[model samples]
Target: MDNANTWFDYIPFNSRGKVGKISVLLLLIAVGLSDFVSASILKPYFERLRPSHSELEGLILLVNKGGKYGFVSSHAANIFAASTILSFFYIHKKKLCLTIAFLVSYSRIYVGVHFPGDVIFGGMLGYLIAIITITFYSKFVLNKNKKKLIG
Candidate 1:
């Protein structure tokens, strides 16, 4: 197949237009912020121990123990943030994005790294961050530059 005008020609997937490129950049920023909040701020403040570190009688850790704290799983936060932002940009792939985020969050628990509450809170935090970021993008970035992007 001729690859001259393929969709992947841009820096990001399907980002042929300025809006798409901006969306991708915002998505990345959202995910990064989510992970930072979960891993650096909240986790340190809460200081909850990972299941792998706790002495659960029957706990069988699939992976090595994680850091000192696990109040919020960064993996869950990052994935959910990415998924939520992607859903905003690609409405048709919302289900797929959410499913992937759910699976990744669940794995954090299944592997005995995070508790159910950790994953839940992480997902919520991620969703909140994504929403805030997307709203900012829509209001400031997209709205302000609508004419430039469209024209």
Candidate 2:
């Protein structure tokens, strides 16, 4: 497998269905925005610090240290949002996306970038945002033309 392809391999950009394509794009954007809001807004509001910066000791980092605030991890939020949105579109792809999401969230904790609470809250925020995005898309785009790919 090519190294660059590794980053591009998972997303099914050329997949069939208009709704599926639009859903992926919109959901991705929503998740990205959600991550931004959580990282920038909520993190400042919560005023949390990363485990590495805090009083914690003896951490083994698989990756580089992360930003200051660890509450509501952006990785967890974005991945979960992508996973949830993809799951809604293609039932067969649900397990893969969700499994990846969980792994990504766990990796944050393992790398000492976030606590379990941070990962969980971030995932929750992402999931909620995805739900709202899907509902809005369904109401405005899907139902506007009375099209059905999935609910």
Candidate 3:
């Protein structure tokens, strides 16, 4: 449980079958890549300025200054993507994960780096990407009966 330890200890390797594990792993990868694409591509495309970059009158800077553009918050997208992926496997903890995602997204706005709309859009982008990933994962990756995955 030490922070210094590697992340392999956290993967649910034993409980899930081979395909299930593969699905989870791929889900993680896809969500991560999706968030990266959103940040790398969409931010520059939108050309929205961060509050720090803009000379606002009363903007309280909580965190350090970020890059030039900040249309969609990358932090929000990444965290929400993780929450969505986790929610697929852990139905019981959906609300908790969502709340955590919401709070994390809100932090971006609270930090004055991104607007409320930016965080909201980032969260939606993550969710939509996750939804697409899970749909493909469910249809192709999971086995018959639609409940579990088998190798």
Q: What TM-score do all the candidates reach, one by one?
A: 0.86, 0.87, 0.80
Q: For candidate 1, what is the lDDT?
A: 0.86
Residue 49, model 2: Cα distance from true site in angstroms: 0.6
Q: Flag the better candidate by lDDT, 1 or 2.
A: 1
Q: What is the C-alpha RMSD of each candidate to the true structure, in Å?
A: 4.7, 3.3, 3.8
Worst 10-residue lDDT window for candidate 3 reads 4-13
Candidates sorted by lDDT, best first: 1, 2, 3
Q: Could you tell me the lDDT of residue 90 within candidate 3?
A: 72
User: In model 3, what lDDT does residue 100 have?
Assistant: 91
lDDT tens digits by residue: candidate 1, 1-151: 3675663652246667876877788788998899889988998898888888888899988998889799888998899889998888778878988999999999999988999999999999999999999899788876888978888
> Model 2, stretches more than 4 Å misplaced?
5-9, 147-151
Q: Please give, for residues 1-151, the per-residue lDDT of candidate 3 as tens digits.
A: 6673454544444446765576478667756776787778999899999888988998789889888888888888887777888788877778988999899999888888988888888888888888877787778755455555333
lDDT of 2: 0.83
